[model samples]
Target: MTRPIAYPSGSWPPRMPADLAAAYCGEASVDVFLRQVKAGSYPQPVVKQGRRQIWAKADLDRAIQPTPDHDIAADVALDL
Candidate 1:
């Protein structure tokens, strides 16, 4: 089985699939979480930044737990 990604502490880079299997994806496998990611229902797999791929913290938050003020229509605009 694949190891679960640990939740980061404070301003940590929003990389890796967190413990969202049960929290967000409703399944108990990171595979399911990953599927959501693949389907764009969860955090994106990667973001291009010249020669680097950065996971935008904002995108991660909006994916798992969308803010009330966040416009649903504009939800698809990934900072990718």
Candidate 2:
């Protein structure tokens, strides 16, 4: 006997691509999202099942969070 894998309701692929787009770009554009992934700037899928790539919702959410802007001036004080 084999144990069944567990997943949240409505959690699956095809949906993941779109979800990633919406989470990152605020729209359903997987093409843009995939491009970023290919460029190594975005988070890749958490897992690969067979031929399908799967991403965790939490991970995707984290990737879309806004990064804090760095201020170079703040790091250095000019003495004139």
Candidate 3:
């Protein structure tokens, strides 16, 4: 099992691209993250510098939070 990445306090380069983000989050592959972003369900990028899409470490931390039970139930109901 891969350990999650830890950001240093007041570190330089607080943003990360998809591949590093995937590894940081312990995701199996970068494609998993890319698909979610393409699907429009993932957190929006903070900025796009050249060809690199960037997200804040804080934003990615927030994105991994589990949705509330009520919200999950509502989504499940809608799918039915």
Clashing pairs in 3: none
3 Cα displacement, candidate 1 (Å): 2.5
Candidate 3's residue-wise lDDT over 6-80, tens digit each? 443554356887766766555556776676777765677788878778888788778766666536566557657
Per-residue lDDT value at 5 in model 3 = 43
Question: Model 1 reaches what TM-score against the true structure?
Answer: 0.42
For model 2, the local distance difference test gives 0.54
lDDT of each: 0.54, 0.54, 0.67
Mark the regions of model 3 whose C-alpha exceeds 4 Å error after superposition.
Answer: 1-13, 70-80
* 11-78: candidate 2 lDDT, tens digit per residue: 44343544444444443355656667788656678776776776666666676565588554553453
- If ranked by lDDT, best first, what sequence of candidates would result? 3, 2, 1
Q: List the residue pairs that clash in candidate 2.
A: none
Model 1: residues with Cα > 4 Å off, grouped in runs: 14-29, 48-54, 66-80
True lDDT of residue 9, candidate 3:
55
Flag the better candidate by TM-score, 1 or 2.
2
